[model samples]
Target: MAEIAFPKDAMRVLKETSRTFYIPITFLQKELKYSVASAYLIFRAIDEIEDHADLDNVVKYEILQQVSELFERPFNNEEYFRILEPVKSIMPDVTIRLEEWLQACPMDVRPIVADAAREMAWGMAKWSKANWNIRTREDLDDYTYYVAGLVGVMLSDLWAHYADEKTDRDLAIGYGRGLQAVNILRNEEEDLGERGVSFVPDGWTRAELFEYAEENLAKADEYMKSLHKKSILLFCRLPLALAHKTLNAMKEGREKMTRAEVEQTVEEIQSE
Candidate 1:
């Protein structure tokens, strides 16, 4: 695969959007790094639309479905611009520059990224249409599968493409779900106050949600244990460790880990 010259601003936008992911992504080797970064930015773009505070659910559904359809065919810059024109003022720069992120992927694995993105967009559309109702554990499972599990599946595919590393798909799904569950926990206040949506199922307490997250995180640990490559292990280790620590912090009545603690975790991982 040819080397990709990622836009100068890509890393900046990534850092602004997610410091946790940005750190691990930076540790990845060249082509794999680019591919993973491109995939993340692409997914994050559509995710912004799904979670937009001001947009009505109807509009969110329309835009997300349009984006999903757009990825179903060969990408046409003009088509994407036209599809998003009406919402341009409210859209974030990341969503507006979707094409750039798509093009940033290495050609060999671009299709895989696009396919995963398309599925995610469609899934987001489905939930948007439903106003993100989560009334049961099964509903939560389906929602997380779309928004997070597919991410695991996509990463597994990318790992295979980049390093010929084969992972258990089920475990990979657990890995993604584990991280996302932690996010739902950490952002529960904001999600409810700002968006008026709750990922927590009906009649479930915070403790139950923690149990749900822990179960999936256990699978994540197994997923990491199955990896033999040092780089892949390192890349996977940071987020999992942070997720574990973040959960611990939350259990202790803290919102999240402090900057010093985050840096300490990274240092320990690097030293290992």
Candidate 2:
């Protein structure tokens, strides 16, 4: 085992950028908390570039490629920040000091985080160069896998690192896919209207997309059922519970969960 310290900057960025994720991550203990948070910040950096409405496609590809290249060697604080400085302000605060996050992660966990970041960055670069023309479900799956499915794999790796039980990687991937699908549906208008990107396949009805999302969420439910630790289970369950609720709400034309609904869901999950 290696020494781990929580980076205040990473915590701040995590809280600032994501509320739902911030809650479940708080349930993670010690090094696992730091590892997962650091990993998340790295992914968020890549996502910020991918989703930047103002950046040119060529610029986005170059920045993402630079990100992928940075993880290939030792973490260089100056060069990393310099290369990404153009979009640093728009990205989460944690991304501003990536090297610090790397320093805080345990040695064993650092490689997993770096590898996943490399894969995500590279994939994002590829898609950005293509302008995200997701013409089919396969294209959508490939894109989501780059941005979200890999998150499931990364969390599964973290779960394995903290506990003795092995995680089913496919189920975990499904968990990511499910959540991303819900996001695509929820943000359909914004992604298309603002970003000119449409995640839904042509000829797909809203009901069909909702069914596709639910099927994957069912896999996510199975992933949760396989976990034994209460904390880990809660960490995996809360977002998933919310995601399912979000999908149901979307069917009714709602975009988000109210605080009361979140609290009630927490109670239901805790009671089960």
Q: Judging by lDDT against the true structure, name the best candidate.
A: 1
Q: Predict model 1's lDDT versus the native.
A: 0.91
Candidate with best TM-score: 1
TM-scores of the candidates are: 0.97, 0.93
lDDT of each: 0.91, 0.83
Candidate 1's C-alpha runs over 4 A off are 1-4
| Tens-digit lDDT string for candidate 2 (2-89) | 3535657678888887777887888888778888877887777677788878889998999889989988888787888788888777
**True lDDT of residue 129, candidate 1:** 96
lDDT tens digits, residues 1-272, model 1?
23536776888899898788898898889888889999999999999999888888998899899999988988887988887888889989998989989888888899999999999999999999999899999999899999999999998998898888989999999999999999999999998998888999999999999999999999999999778777788889999999999999999999999999999999999889
